[model samples]
Target: MTPPSAPPPPADGLLAAGRRNLRALAHAVSHPSHPPTPLFADAPKRWQRLLPYVVVVALVATFLPLTITVLTDYGMSGGLAGAIAAVQTVPLLMIAHRPLQAWWIILPADVVGGLFALGGPASQSSWPWTPSVIVAYLFLMLALALRETRQTLIGVWLVTGAAGAVLGRLFPGESDGTNVLLLVLSAVVLVIGGALRERGEAQRRLVEQETISEAERAHRTLLEERTRIARELHDVVAHHMSVITVQADSAPYRVGGLPPEAQAEFASIAASARESLTEMRRLLSVLRSEDATGERAPQPGLDRLQQLVEATVRAGVPAGLSLTAGLAEPGRLPQTIDLSAYRIVQEALANVVRHAPGADTRVSVSSDGTDLTVLVVNGPPAGPASPVEAGGAGGHGLVGMRERVRLTGGTLDTGPLPDGGFRVAARLPLGTKEPVSP
Candidate 1:
């Protein structure tokens, strides 16, 4: 059997730990890329008037004992002693703006003090890996990690490691200062710093993405509302324009002979109105073509309710309409309310034609001064539904009715009735409006 291996050196544990940390850092960035000195991880807050000053005082305090030891034991001049103190504290002061660069400043300052300014490397860990320099680097790394990106963090870790490795070899200390173990410990700290930086970046990106998604969703909703308004405009305006064209064309015949110029002007108005109506219908078809059959038809309103009911009746459903609350009166309804009422009626009737075919359907409209109420009811179906039922709008008819009532600041109720029929009703509030003649 092979002889038992010698126990590993003490520094080997530090090396292993550092490598494990470096691996963890790599994994963190491979996937993606808090609080305080309470955690040894917070950057000083610059907004507080005394935070920077406090940091300077605290860093100076830490180095004070070391500074005196360097002065008395090394016999360094007073000016040189002050210079070493400055190297340790100034970087800590400047850490917020230029943390990585501050780290660079502290590292070489420690080297210079170790080699030339202070006494010989006689007492402890020599030149590069001295205690003072280690403290400076730790503080600086903690600050820099909060600000730097993953790539910059890797560069920082490498630079610090390489510098320590080279110096350790050149001026080896009593405690193996020039050894790879110093580089390992440095790697561990810097890797942890880099991991922290990446996490911060990832969280910032998540918040930004959420904000963008919210804005995009709002924009999309606005565009959809605009499109629906345009469709309603087409349906309502085209009907009025067609009526205007007919009235203009028939005015001379209905009233009496007119002057030649007046007749020509009326003809011009009729032609223009007909052209506009044609274009509106075309646009509506393009925007809302419901079937591949490609049938293009005029939009219907209350004026066309009789024709619509006749068609529904012919399609095997008996349908009728009742009107009250001055809604039955012609020519005084607000155009917006008229259009909404028509569309609501159309959608409810369509639902009946599809879902409850062969069922008797009744649509009733009643209004108090402030609100118009619409109700559509259908008897239970007599038999299996036709293909129209299978291919008809899925749940979208109710959705459209709800939106229409919502636009009017209204309430809608729809459900099965106790009598084995379905009921759809809406109470739409009418705001004050200047009435338009029919």
Candidate 2:
């Protein structure tokens, strides 16, 4: 068995805390290896570029007279007083580069300047803190507050107060509350500068987050559109495969074929078509989201265009539809082409209603035997755009339309009209296997 150790003394904890604080202060002030922090890094305008130089000029102008006054009042030689004034003022330029280092230089220069100015014939009210030194230190504190950590700033403030106290004790005279005044002014400047820097950082973070969110949303929308296109195309392809399977299975019996090899070949064709349909359905299941119940209704075709246009007209956008007489004949166009054409027109009209409320719109569909042309155009809005529209409600209008047309090897054209309206036109080849006319 080991002997138990005695409890540590209470002073041990206090000593540890003091050592920790001192270490923290040392770490806060000593590391000045970071790149320079520009005061106007993002200034884009001409006046903004010139503003920093203007501030330097103004500070120089103000410090000039104060330096002359300090020289006369302190009764120091010209070169000595001017050198001290230069130490106080010139380090301000370094604040943009190494603020903590600048503070280290300025604080000591301030102490020495105060020591010489004490009890001078010209020194009346102000004691250790001359008007010029107060102003210069305040500026330095403001820069430090913006760039440095709060611990560093607290260290700087504590050191400033300690310096003023030491100078007061060394030369006891009518100190005139200059020490308190300088500390209070520097504290206020530090607080305001810290607040402004925090606000700017928060704004930058917010903008960056918004940009990332926008990119993610666009990517999500693209994936959803592709899934929808695959689902619809699956349905179209499945229908054609089902027809091929039935025709191949029935050909031997219905056509009165005599050869056994021919019947076996027909059977093979039917089996292959059925297998393909089964795989497509499996692939479709993977494409569909879990929440989708699977639409069992027959997909709409070009025949539904009139009803779509009528619905849009009832919704407030005065609209008209035109369909060529031949398009009415059933089986005139394949199911894939028919579905693609209908979806393009449906999305286009929906966009008009949402984006250009109360605008005149026209939708026309015609087939020239080799190609099918669809056109939907809407005029400018008769009323002000709703907040939702102006803010871009994030509809997948153009994305869906372009995808549908592309599946059928079609061409799509969409843009804003010169009359402040919108146009969406698509030309689809009549036969998928045939080359499209230029």
Candidate 3:
């Protein structure tokens, strides 16, 4: 019986949501498309840091005038007014820290205070609302709307409705006070709060999408730049290569008394130059996740080692290949690694022809199941080491070979032999394919 497959990974929760929201906010704030007062506005560090303090001071000041007005209008006497001011101040302070809890405290206290104050001779003066009534309701409603989540705000709205019902019934007519006002204000708060919440959510999504679009744009720019560089390289490098091919192909007929072997060598040089040019074209046009328009040339691998060795021989380097014992199934190697191994051997041979002409060379590929090694050794040159190519170009052959080996998770070691010959050895590990970086 098949055991049920392990459950798919759980969706992210609150912590992930918080982090994503923070990232979106940061991106939005830094984006030029945003308004001046972005959710997490990017102001001067000092001002940005001080913004909370400024908000706190503003809230305090907003409520202070109302508190004084309440004491003046509702309190029976001077000492009583001061005491009333203290009572009102307490709730404002509490609301600053915990709006919901402050609402619970202030509602019953204000209702009871209003009922008891009715006994005083001056109680009838203020009529329905105390002088401070508008500010008190306004601050509390705004506080609830901003601080509470939408789900919790529903409960706040219900509670406000119930309070309104009770206060309207208890006070009645002229003593109805600000009960009707509170009810209307509660509805307004809910509408505004929900709208703002939805707006914020929309902004977060927009920010995330903008981030993705920006990344795609940057990637497209990179691909365009690569195409431009490839065009330039084709002009500078491929032109010289084409000239070499033409020169090598025509050299035998250009001069009289050339031996059969010398003519064959020219032919080999022409063929090798053409082959290099084909590979360069393949590499220049490669793009990540691209679909080829036609079937591409099969990449050269270890199986082509004999033909490569023969070509090098014809190019004046008597080259031999040593295939290791354990590499029983060459096809099992990763396509990229196989191609890389072949290129490393090919480049090493070409380097010998240019840098150490007429040198005897050996190419070896060995695999012990887990790792493959490709090593090339060429004997001391017949003449001085020519560091530059025949066309006066400082070739990047060694650097290119090292890069190919590295892409296959391999290491390359290359330097002059103790006796004056040059050696290029590459060690490639199996099982991993290195991704090409942009």
Candidate 4:
């Protein structure tokens, strides 16, 4: 059988340290090691809206070089003609960078540039700029579709198409059916891709939120279970120890006026019982949750066998406790070993108080390399007064101690001693121990 595992340390220190470090890192990141303010925060939306206008200006700029070439051939001064053409390209550059607000500036610039191209002394027709316009429009729409949702891309496409149709009507161009169909198909692809991206992002976020919620619920359930177990342990120890305390305190007074040696023995028993009560109280104090501010102390471990023996003594039982090795070096003993050892001793002493009052008891604890051994023996009840209430009442103390020992992969033997008393002995393996049956 496997030995019982050790209990976990209290969570307060580790959890607090983790939270402190996380908070510090969050504060440091928010402030940054070196801070810089970002620019153009509001520029993207404006740029999206002005994209079509920017495309129109770019198309106009593309036709300028050819127009200027013909104008110079017809006797226009080369330097003067080049200056006029250069002016038309300005709006295109500005609109490309600041699309939304560029319309107010570019619309007037477009009319002047258009007049110059159409009415110059060396003017020539370069009317159909459809291919350049279509390419620029497609590029802008593709960018918007990749960055935004379907609805926004659709709005942009509709606006650009309507404006383009109006310009085409005013300045007639040759267009084949296939070119128009390709343009429409490209626009449809942009809208579909944008819609899918938005849908996928939404679904991913929903799944993440659900996962977080489930984890939080599991954490709360674990906390509740821990609290419930703590409460049960507290209740069990308090009830049984309280009974032992009453019986121990009343024993000396009940058997009055005995021989000096007998009286001294009874007094020693009372003192031992008081000490046990004190240690039990100390153990209970440690078990109290940290939320309480009272001065209650922490519980005892296997290190306090003397105190246990003293308590047994106060209960009118003569207890001789011998320890070959103190708990100073638990070595590889698991937490279960420590807890079970403490509990087994506590239960054994309580049994002496209840079922073997005024009897001589011997408590011994020794470790042989890998196994811990505990033996508690008591001579029969001192008087005919039946030390225990009899029946099943005297059985449970031994059963409980055995069960605790077994959980640590130990063996327990409890039965009548040849000398007319009872003895309980347990051997708990330091490694790979299994639970003992009651």
CA lDDT scores, all candidates in order: 0.68, 0.83, 0.66, 0.58
Candidate 2, 96-168: lDDT as tens digits: 6477888888899888888777667743568788888888788788878878877888888888898888877
RMSD of each: 14.0, 4.4, 20.8, 24.5
**Segments of candidate 4 deviating more than 4 angstroms:** 1-129, 172-186, 203-207, 214-218, 221-225, 235-337, 340-438
lDDT of 2 at 212: 100
RMSD of 2: 4.4
Q: What digit string (tens of lDDT, one per residue) describes model 1 on residues 131-224?
A: 5656656667666666656555665666667666666566554325443554666567767877876787788799999999978966665555
lDDT of 1 at 228: 70
Q: Which stretches of candidate 2 lie over 4 Å from their true place?
A: 1-14, 32-34, 96-98, 173-175, 258-261, 367-371, 429-438
lDDT of 3 by residue, 101-142 (tens): 656666665555556456445554543345464457566666
**Rank list by lDDT:** 2, 1, 3, 4
For 372-420, candidate 4 gives per-residue lDDT tens digits of: 8888888987855453455424434554665566557788888897878
Ranking by TM-score: 2, 1, 3, 4
Query: What's the lDDT for candidate 3?
Result: 0.66
Off by over 4 Å in 3: 1-87, 90-122, 125-133, 143-152, 166-177, 189-219, 251-268, 284-438
Against the true structure, candidate 4 has what lDDT?
A: 0.58
- TM-score, candidate 1, is 0.56
Give the TM-score (vs. native) of candidate 2.
0.87
Residue 389's lDDT within candidate 4 is 54
